[model samples]
Target chain A: MSLRLQARKLACERDDRWLFRGLDLDIRAGEIVRVEGPNGSGKTTLLKILSGQLADYHGELFWNEAPMRRSRKAFLANLLYLGHSPGVKAALTPLENLAWYQALAGEPDDAAARLEALASVGLVGFEEVPAGQLSAGQQRRVALARLTLIPRPLWVLDEPFTAIDRDGVVALEARLSAHARQGGCVLVTTHHALAASSALRRIRLGQGGDDAGA
Target chain B: MPGPDASPVSEQQAGVACREPREGTAVAVRATLKRDLVLMLRRRSEVLNPLVFFALVITLFPIGISPDPALLASIAPGLLWVAALLAALLSLDSLFRSDFEDGSLEQLLLSPQPLPALVLAKVAVHWLLTGLPLALMAPVLGIMLSLPAGSYAVLALSLALGSASLSLIGAIGAALIVGLSRGGVLLSLLVLPLYIPVLIFGAGAVQAAILGAGVAAHLAILGALLAVALMFAPWAIAASLRISING
Candidate 1:
């Protein structure tokens, strides 16, 4: 299987403020790499860099050995990154939101199936209602609905469990575990420990030493 | 539902699965335009605000400044064009703000389609909402201004080209300032100066028509500005959006 993510000497900065420097990491197929760190530790920045959202960072990030900086669309097409914000438009119905997302992700005709995915995420009766009217957890679930499609090979989740209820968190863990079991990779940053049976590895950032251990 | 032909069934299902990743440019552009148009239509207020602003500004001149038919007729073209520009700028702040706030902008950035194409779709919808309506309403306002019968053609033509350019160029400012909260007023301040050339040519075309110098030169300039913006604004807007979004 191809290497899912490979970062070499990755460095990131914002507003002349150095966030991370000379960091290297890798995740292979069927792997779950959790990035643990305190707030302002640049976890989200690192995820954005790895996911090909920020290109000004130093060093190299490769998805399937292709430089992520050069061809982001191919890289992004193979991965899904859920940031802190759920990213759903409030005025658009859940189905409409998913349908637009599918099209933007280049999956226009998949609205019917996308609606099914939305339903699986507990957005059943509210499928046609604008996402803004839904509760916070429901909106997050609307974003999570994209995971059920499974077209992408890698999932980079930043604080996915934020605002999720206890049951929802368990369901998410199971989904992540199943994704890894199916030879997919997941790079996630979360405050809570994810309990799963998969071969999980943790990378704790922002420590005094180079403390990279599984 | 299982049967001896389950293998074929599974193969067909694989071929026709939902949630599959999309992978083309033209298809993506079409889909994006459709989505944007639908959103613009549903949010009727956003579409009408600029038009109303145009009419209000046009009406304000006759009430606050002067109702003298001679003066209104002479200044109508300039007032109408200027008002339309301001009105368009008024609505441009929402071009990306709502999307950026709701995370839809990030999804658009993640799309496999080129960012410029997505930006074009957005600009197109903006033109439909803000620019197109103002263009249609120019003649009505022209009559109010007592615009010479001969200059009405030039007035309408200049507005069409001029507002299209305004939408395109305003999109650049909108994308740049979207990262900042309360970007609406600041966006106008930033984009208004940039619209000087369009406003110049747009109003000049009408003035020339009344002066019997032929409106061709001004119309051509307005068209040229529109072309220049069409060529460059998308790339600029897309790049700016990426910077603000990732920052």
Candidate 2:
């Protein structure tokens, strides 16, 4: 419950274009920060940098008090990063996918409870179907199903609600809210405005860098 | 290295009561073999397709070249081995392409199990599917090429060992080129040279056996190549894959 994600003078580039520069941000436990920006404004890149997935950026990112460069794997192990792609294997059933993902995350929790978590995401009846056959929204639901079993404290999501239907989006918001209420921290990027039930903070990536706009 | 079960829960959360289980390299290797076997079974056609291609290429050689038995026998080992190498190369694209495209590769990268272990499992699977079947089929095709029975064992053994080396080495190439446009042809260009050592020794083994010379030396070379690839390719390929995905 003592996790802290902070960045100072962080700058990033994608394909030689400066996406963001000289950005500073801080989020402690119990804060849900939302990153909103225009298309191709580097919301995803910033999330990846924060999640330790992309590390070739300039300036500093600190997890707790240590430099992110020194403790990357340790940092990544505690962060759950869900990109625009749900990252579910299409050939495997939803249940099978979740089982493997839970193992990948090094969670040793009960598989039965994992299945129950899938059910919690309203994927009970479709658990046996391969994800390739599922609709886009359903596939997303299966990906989000990981939240039920894994216990990582930080969730970094990029456009997490993209393909989810209206009802699915609402359900996901509730899950994010519950996660934050339980002393977890979330950093997400989205185009759609999230409802106010969750105490979600906001950070908008403008033409310059991350600041309090939009 | 510690086993998957022995991995610490957290960097700082050590000194817990229970001792973590340690799965050694042997268990990791066995688990890898099992997973590869299952994947091969599920994709049976993909496994056999390369063998069929190998057989087809050998079949064409007889019609494309002289049908005389002596002439065909003289070059059969090298021809069949080259065709098999190319066939293996043709299917290398499928090794990580599907998984990468479907997003499964990302999940694998995130796995607590070492990425190298998972990559070794994948390379093993590729060898089982594409390389092993070609080795098994080479003996049957060798007869059509008029390869002597005495040399057939050498051919099969060399191919079995050598094609495995190809898969391991090719994995690095495949991973490096996974996300690029026109990657398949580029991959061939990158890996085909690396495959030459395996080919030279594999075909040379059978050729030496045909000459009534000691084929053991040639077979030993192929085995050494396989061993080297087995030791290094997994780590290199895993690193290249991470770089490619992150890029």
True contacts kept of each: 0.37, 0.16
Candidate 2 lDDT over residue span B1-247, tens digit each: 1122332335213211112222243444454455446556767787777888898999999899989999999999899999999999988988888778767777667554677887898898888778888898999999998988798888888999999999999999999998785798899999999999898888899899999999989989998999899999999999989898888
RMSD of each: 3.9, 5.7
Which RMSD does model 2 reach against the true structure? 5.7
What digit string (tens of lDDT, one per residue) describes model 1 on residues B103-145? 7787788777789988998899899878888998999988877
Report the TM-score of candidate 2, chain A only.
0.93
lDDT string for model 2 (A26-97, tens) is 877666899977988888888877887676788798877888877566665667778788877676778767
Model 1, runs deviating above 4 Å: A13-18, A207-213, B1-22
Clashing pairs for model 1 are A87-B103, A106-B22
CA shift at B199, candidate 1, in angstroms? 1.0
Best-matching candidate per lDDT: 1
